[model samples]
Target chain A: MTATVHRLRKAAPSLDPMLALVAGDMNAVNAVILDRMQSQIPLIPELAGHLIAGGGKRMRPMLTLASARLIGYTGTRHHRLAAAVEFIHTATLLHDDVVDGSDLRRGRRTANIIWGNPASVLVGDFLFSRSFELMVEDGSLKVLKILSNASAVIAEGEVNQLTAARRVDLGEDRYLDIIGAKTAALFAAACRIAAVVAERPEAEETALDAYGRNLGIAFQLVDDAIDYVSDAGTMGKDAGDDFREGKMTLPVILAHARGTPEERQFWKDAVEGRRDSDADFAHAVELVQRSRAVDDTLARARHYGQRAIDAIAGFPDGAAKAAMVEAVEFAVARAY
Target chain B: MTATVHRLRKAAPSLDPMLALVAGDMNAVNAVILDRMQSQIPLIPELAGHLIAGGGKRMRPMLTLASARLIGYTGTRHHRLAAAVEFIHTATLLHDDVVDGSDLRRGRRTANIIWGNPASVLVGDFLFSRSFELMVEDGSLKVLKILSNASAVIAEGEVNQLTAARRVDLGEDRYLDIIGAKTAALFAAACRIAAVVAERPEAEETALDAYGRNLGIAFQLVDDAIDYVSDAGTMGKDAGDDFREGKMTLPVILAHARGTPEERQFWKDAVEGRRDSDADFAHAVELVQRSRAVDDTLARARHYGQRAIDAIAGFPDGAAKAAMVEAVEFAVARAY
Candidate 1:
């Protein structure tokens, strides 16, 4: 009679190799980020720094740098573009905190919570404008096109999510579209610009884009799944936070789809903001587990992760590719 | 007994001539605006149209078009750039409404009021991103640099104003800086981009830029002055709205500076949110009038208006020049 250990991940899939692959490049991005975020208006840097200095994994920029390595490109043009990508991501996060009224991010108080919504909104605008300036400085019309279009898509997706909020009938298809625009658009743009800066062929750009887009979707789904995992080990995300906020994510969608009539009513009530207490959340975890919603969510993640790895399969099989593959695995396995 | 009209303007000083000058070009610009404001998300157009079609003067875009005419630019490139300028202006207005928590704009319910702040914010971001898409489409790095830097300056100005809010000690110099960034930066960029598209000389570009910058500062000063006028005819700006919101404008700065000790205390109380009743507002107006703060503010606007006219004096004396000069006079005289 021995206790069983249920580990969902294979060995220790980690971002360590990817971090090692681009550690020096990330430092350059950090410097660009710091230099560009500054303003004579003190509040700009103060509010922007709160989130930039907070513990984001720099995944989007890291993708840019690693993709460059995959192409065997030795140019430094990718550095500015990577910083621009990070700035775009940071702008989105700042606005998201305000739109979500979120108080905590990466285990610290959100900029909106600390600096107020107006400051957050204005600083986000500054960073966004600064991103375009950086792109223009890079002097690549193709890169500008990719990023400017991506920015518009991300904003459209944000509005899509806002309208879909608190709705019990948001199907998986629309949910996919929403996340595709809001989350994956930037990811794709970040990777695609690396190919553009490297002067690679259109095929390479499209391939890297596919890689980032698929990984972004998988990463977001696992993040959604982690919200219901009672023993979640993630640093900033507390379990049941989304449940309390009536956030519409895939696990809830799947659980509601497979639920009994009474359980369905429970989910509807919870989503509509009636049932949000600890007992209700506990019951929610139980329901999702019994229905295997979280498990299936992670399973879905792995499917996309495979697609992500395959997207870049044509590139050389070395440290860059291996680290990228492991990073995708790490994204999907974080829920464990 | 004959009535003393006491009109501040010398002649009619209407914008009709400028309107007539750019009527054809503006139609092209309006088409671009309507076409580009659209998105698959119906809400984007709906929310944006509430302001875009809701009776804005389209002053910024008109500057672009009219500047092109002044520079003898025959290409249609300025049309897209003009629409882009309007998009940036519209985006800023939408966010401004949200930041101010404004309920009404141009006498109609604000988008933020009707669609919610979240919609307004996201739509503003969408339009901002869309503006960049237009710039990228135009494929002018020079124009992109000018507009993007203007955007950053505008955001910085907004944050500066936020930090300066409710401070009676906000001096006239800082007030100029705030309005310069928030209002004049875009005007200068809008005018300068016309020169870029026209491939004009740097001297001509600088001339157009100075003209627009001076006019913008004058235009904003008049707008600020209108808020204190007992009979402000500007449809959108309500008298005492700024006073109630503790907004730090030149009128308050001057009125505070020249006040008696007791009057200074009154202003401090008003700016600090202690005095905001209807009667209190009436008293505040009286204090500013007695100090001649409103009159002095208009005088300052006239000085800038004169400079605006003089900056473009070097341009050929033609219909464009006359219209532009009249436009400046019209702006400075609007409070009448």
Candidate 2:
């Protein structure tokens, strides 16, 4: 346990500095989130509160806040926008839990489990609508266009993932495209909006967008890797959930690609046939480890993480920029 | 069959005149809808097409088109906004079917039944995001605000209905609030967007909103009444679906209000206790008939229908206005 703690410490710098830097803004964002989530319909607040109150790290919203600060945005619009970003994220999580038939989130029972799929889906719709309301209130057409487009793209990605589920032939480029649309589009939108509100130049906007897009790809790649390497206690979900659910994440795709004919047959059985017993999971993990698929996935994540750092190279050196860079590293290093 | 056809013919004036007036714009809206519903993910279009092609009366989009024509506005933006309205309604229907666990819609299998709940939820989300994309493309903040707020209210109403499900104590006022949010909010927003895009006076906007809101309430009241009075062949869903699902629609609420001790007990058993069977549905239908709940519900519907006419009475009499008035009558008379 001590060694594990020490290794974790050496894994990467904490997000503490970034969190601290934007703590004041984050508090305001939280207030908006709490206030906007309220509804006269009791079940809405009750169901939404269960998920929001479970308190996952507000990583996406932090990116919005951090990017805004990095771009030297001085107005209060970013707070509302940050809250909007969190609402969008939370809304997707609710619907994703329903779509994934997930049992646990953040080590707690998912809202869908407690309230049923209907409530989760409806509350998710409510949160999504509320996010748009916030965006409308922000009163920026450019921002609205960016965020709304990102939302559409996110849905497309989810559908693409659905189509790709359980297919052994799922390619790496398609996997990246799925993550790019589902995860990075929002990250790009969230950061780009800071530039929009800051009234920054197009180049700055593009830079921040690239930074967010790459960071988001890295974040998801590392997340897929962590599923293979981490335990349920650390990952907040059972290991090999993707395998059981027949999800085609990066490591699974890579491992399948590099595996022997026998190993390939094993994946087809475990994933496509859904023969995911404990033994199957154990064997799958061993195969993935042997193929160095986890290492390859992390390497890809680091590649994107570095691009994220490069995307913001044009920005002047500042505490916010430093923190943002550390955040990219932190996202990648989580797999270690 | 002949007698039923005669009754349906006498029950309502057709929406054909209104549909005819806006046929060109409606065609354009359909084109946009077909165009926008497409995604690289084949499953999305495939699933959305199954539902969209099943062909419910495009009444909501017609409302937007007719409302725009009523105000003598000449713009193509209404076509897109109307499409957006239909998309919102369709998205809600997809989600609602999932929430209701419905098996049939429009005399066909439901999307959830065909594609599974996960696909339905995600595709519903895709449609919703697409709706927002349309709204943003229309590029009106007022329209965005109205539609987005309506979306939020719609979800809230769905949650309220969930909470009120199987509860015999739900009052009429709460019932009105629920339908107002779930059904009428979109109608109101749809009609109001016509005025918004036309840059009409505040009075015109308010008047259109009232017309749509009251019309929506009337429409729902008649729909609930039809569930008891009409057969599955006509209603495109099994009769007594509301009763079977323990939904607190007006007819059920009214029947409960007017029932004797024994009948009330029967409702409690069939609805709240989830003991509904074919016999229970038959008995419930009989009790509703005896209590005149269907008639009373239609009377309430007519009252709102009349108010919808009155709300638009200030407008000069014209073909557009006449068609709008006929729509209200058609909504109420559907219960006949």
The candidate that achieves the highest DockQ relative to the unseen native structure: 1
lDDT tens readout by residue for model 1, B1-336: 443222235886989989999999999999999999999888999999989999999999999988999989988999999999999999999999989999988888999889988898899999999999999999999999999999999999999999998889999999999999999999999999999999999999999999999999999999989989988866477898889988989999999999999999999999899999999999989988999999999999999998998888778777888889889989999887
Model 1 regions lying over 4 Å from their true place:
A1-9, B1-9
* A243-273 per-residue lDDT for model 1 (tens digits): 9999999999999999999999998999999
Q: How accurate is candidate 2 locally (lDDT)?
A: 0.87
> What is the TM-score of each predicted model, taking all chains together?
0.97, 0.96
Pairs in steric clash, model 1: none
Estimate, for each residue in A144-235, the C-alpha lDDT of model 2 and write its tens digit.
89988898899899889888888888899999999999999999998899999999999999999999999999999988888787453444
| Per-residue C-alpha lDDT of model 2 across residues B6-61, encoded as one tens digit per residue | 11124458777798889889899999999999998999999999988887888899
